[model samples]
Target chain A: MEWDWAFVMQILPTLFEGVKITILATLLGSIVAAALGLVIAILRRSKYRLISMPTGFIAEFIRGTPLLVQLYFIFYVLPDMGITLAPLVAGVIGLGLHYGTYAAEVYRAGIENVARGQWEAAKACNLTAFQTWTRVILPQALPPMIPALANYFIAMFKETPLLSAITVLELMNQARSIANFNYRYIEPITLVGAFFLAISLISVIGLRWLERRYGRIG
Target chain B: MININRLGGAVSAAVLSSLLFAIPAKAEDTLEKLKEQGFARIAIANEPPFTAVNPDGTVSGAGPDVARAVFKKLGVNDVVASISEYGAMIPGLQAGRHDAVTAGLFMKPERCNAVAYSEPILCDAEAFLVKKGNPQGFKSYADIAKDSSATIGAPGGGTEERLSLEAGVPRDRVIVVPDGQSGLKMLQDGRIDVYSLPVLSINDLVKKANDPNIEVVAPVVGAPVYCDGAAFRKNDTALRDAFDKELAAMKQSGEFAKIIEPYGFSAEAAMSTTREKLCSASN
Candidate 1:
């Protein structure tokens, strides 16, 4: 079909609003994922099986299930149990919980990569458990994981479109709605692709810079 | 690997662009086409009483039934139907993906400009599915718009969505429910405050849902009645004319009422209206 620049101009404002929601969800979801992943990783390293085993299983369960199904359960199924959340909130939780599991694995690798002597050094320094973790282990374990964590966050951003399934007014949903209204899928869909490509390329550059900055870490 | 991905992307883009821009088939002896093929390809939506896809994969509902009979009279043996969304129906027909849209795709001025429509066939009024006792008392689209916190669930690109938007409900508040079942589910889950569809469609959904907690508010306040005809591509006037002639004859023979009445459509409502009048009527 012919490219309709006028139509593109008309749809830009609505699409930008959708873009804002998409970015907001990705940012919020990333924060939730990063924090929750660290918690799971630390808990899984505990000496008690009661803590470690269940933590591992729960992370695996979250990891194994599809995010779309999880979104449906959160948006459609949760209300039956009296746990209703707004569409965006339900979408954010689904994204965060699912990606948090993968983030947990990245944390595990980074923590494991730290030298065995680091723990011994912390003990010899007479540091308490909290100080040992906060001051010694994490500082060393964290930098190398930045690139990997950034990668997952970028991956999570791409997946933000899945939020539309739960009725979140995100970018993809906006494009579809516009397409349906105007009977023109080409323009709106092309605009969506362009927006996604621009964001993904910028983030890839950021990821490359991160890899360089943290390249020498253990 | 990056080079391969780039190449693959380019190839797929070419394929998609070709499909999107492909010329619509010329309507040379369009009626003869159906006679030779033994069936006409019609687009339908899966909203029962208007259009439905049976569990056995056969297509039924008032719109298709009327189209089937009309086509048969024109020496077309049967109609092959595919389900589509209301928004995509016209574009799909223009793209040559469907020969005619027999679904309850209502006639409006903008739509009439895009496609050639036969006389009106299935007519309906707007209805809302709400909590029992009409908790919010949403009698019209304006009422939903007035309640700042209320949201409506309607089929994407359907008349209900357009009407709600025209009535001043903001875009975010009008949730695009995919199908009848999902709309019902969303209403039950309190995801949307009101689920809007045509009167017969709401009735059909309510009957199947059999839920005591839900109720129907028909003849939505301030929404006008609408009618849908068999819509063909703009250049397919000869085919449209043939279909219209048979449709009018069917109406005269009392056959049109038989096909649509069982599905809860009022044939008189359709018979009393003309495509020109419905298409030109102000919304």
Candidate 2:
């Protein structure tokens, strides 16, 4: 079918609502990934093998599996065990848990990039372990990791369409619904492509800005 | 972002070329092509009675059985079936992904306008698969819409979803369940208050599940009984008409009744309605 511009205009408002949910899922998922990754990284680095081994395996497991299957487990399987989450909550959890493992790797690299001398110097200064991590190592480690972590979040943003599997009304889902109803894919699907391209372009610019702000290792 | 730019460029190029090729196309050759190809591609929903896939991976059920017989009569050797969601069938036909959709994708004015539909094939009324008691007392789409907390699930892009929307349920409230089994799971999980589909499809799922916790409410209030036809691409009217001719003869010869009745579809219901009447009926 020919591209119907009018149909595009008509469906934009509905699609924009979907875009809002997509952005919300991405933003919330990014926050979860950032926090959870730090916890996993710290746990995996623990002196006790009991904690570290399981933590490492879990992270590996989460990273090793497909996000879509994980989403189905969270959305469908978990409910049978009496833990029912709303569609958005389950989607965000899936997105965060899957990406958090990758983020943990980034965390490990960033922390390792902090030289041993810095830790020894913090110990010599009589600073506590918390102080060493917070004041010295983190300040040094975090800046360079921003670009890598931001890259994951942007990647996560593109993958948000998978949320539709569990019935999150994200952009791709909304576009499909519109196309299904109208029996016209040319406009709705093309609009979805346009929306995704525009958003990714904008996010890439933001990533560049983030890189400029926190990119330097020194 | 560069990839996005490439995607945008590629989409535009594809759309432009399609437009260029839209006219001066070859004429009435789809049937000829299918006959030569040995099999007509047909879309089925995998929802039983209407359409189903067997354990051996062969396709059967009333819709495909009828379509297969019609194609065999049309001199095509076999019908190749693909399981598709109801919503994708029309677009799939348009995209040349399938020759015709034998899925119980009900005929509506919008769908009638979109595809070349053969005379109506399978007919059924809407039904809800709700909690054992149907505690919310939902007998109709309007009932679910009126209850603000109530959520209903239907197969994505299916007629039940459209009916729910038309009945004034908010978009967020009408969950697009992926399939019959999932819909039943969602119902048991209490993720959705009601799951809707054709009456027979729901019965088939409930019977398979043997779940006492669920019940079916058939002939949903104010929702008229609807029928589905094998949908061909808009430009494939010649193929549709040829298929229709075979189908009409089968109906006249009692073959159609024998093929469909064992699957629990009422042959008279389908035979009594005309596409013009269903398509022009006020929604």
Candidate 3:
């Protein structure tokens, strides 16, 4: 199919609006995922089985299911239960919660990678539990986890297209609407691919910088 | 490892060669190809009264009924139906995925540029499915746009969505619902303020839903009554012309009315306009 420069120019503004929402969803979702993952990782480490066992099971359940189905349930079914969420809110929550489970595993591994001597050393310094975690343990744990967490952030950005199924008016949805209206699939679909590639490439470059800066655990 | 790689290369080569051989040879005539195959694949949407799949998996609706009758007259013995969304049908036809689209896809100037269409077969006016008593006071697409908080659901890639956009409804407010059933469900659950479809299709859905809270507003203000025709790939004009000739004869002999009348469509309305007029008309 031939590319139409005029058609591409006409749709650029509308598509740019969608791109703003796409990036917004990813940024907000990444924040939620990073925060929720820490909470889940900390809770799962609890000595009480009442807290840790159920938390482990729930995280596994969410991780086991497809993200698209989860999105549908939140956007369509949750309203029936009187828990209606605005489209963007539902989309971000779905993305955050789904990726948060996977991120939790990374956090758990990072925390576990801290040598047992580090905790014992904190105790030798007469540090309280909070001081041990906040001062000695987490600073050492968090740096190495940055590369993996950045990878999931990139993945979550790619998965933002699935939000279109719930009518979030994201980039892919906007492209499909333009394609449907004009009866031309080539230009819009190609433009979406180009946009994704450009963003992902930039994210990769950023991820490499993060890895170089934070990869050393010492 | 080298042996395994060699085996993989050989297997892929065989598969690629077989795929090349599987391509169908071009037929000199479209009708000849259909007659030899004995069944023509037609695309339909599962929108009731217009096109639908029966419980036993048989396809029957006003659009397909008229299409089947006309194809039979043209010597195609059977019509096999595949349910598809309105937006995908034309591209499917162009890709040779289906022989024709009988999915009540309305004829528009943009669409006319893509495929050859037979004479108009099903005609209908726009309608909205709203909550009882019309809480939003939404009588039309323009009204939906006026209320910034309102969301309207319409089938993806259909005329209603286009009408809503043309009426100045923001892209975010016009939700592309998957089907008539989900549209009804969305309206019932307050996910969308209004569900848009043709009059007959809305009646069928609201009846099937049996929900007292929903009501239909027909002839949505400022939208024209749209007519649909069986669409074929642009290269299949000979087959389309033949089908149109038989369709015109059926309309003349009152046979067309008999087939579509039971489905609650007015044959006179369909016959009142020509494809030329609809295709060339300015919105």
Instruction: Candidate 2: give the clashing pairs.
Output: none
Residues A12-39 of candidate 2: C-alpha lDDT, one tens digit per residue: 9999999999999999999999999989
Which DockQ-derived CAPRI band holds candidate 1? medium
Worst 10 residues of 1 chain B by lDDT: B21-30
DockQ winner, 1 or 3: 1
Best candidate, DockQ-wise? Answer: 2
Over 4 Å off, model 3? A123-126, A216-218, B1-28, B54-58, B252-255
* TM-score, per-candidate, Cα-based: 0.88, 0.92, 0.91
State each model's CA lDDT, in order: 0.91, 0.90, 0.91
Ranked by lDDT from best down, the candidates are 1, 3, 2
lDDT over C-alpha atoms for residue B123 of model 3: 94
lDDT of 1: 0.91
lDDT of 1 at B257: 91
Q: State which candidate has the highest lDDT.
A: 1
Candidate 1, residues A1-218, lDDT tens digits: the string is 79999999999999999999999999999999998898998899999999999999999888888999899889888887988798999988898888888899999999888899999999999999999989998898889999999999999999999998778999999998999888899999899999999999999999899999986334
Question: What would the per-residue lDDT of candidate 3 be over residues B1-283, giving only the tens digit for each residue?
Answer: 3799889999999999988875443535788889888888999999999998999999999999998999899889999999987777887788788999998899999899999999999999999999999888888899999999999999888999988998999988999888888788788888899999999999999889998998889889888889999999888889898999999999999999999999889899999999999999899
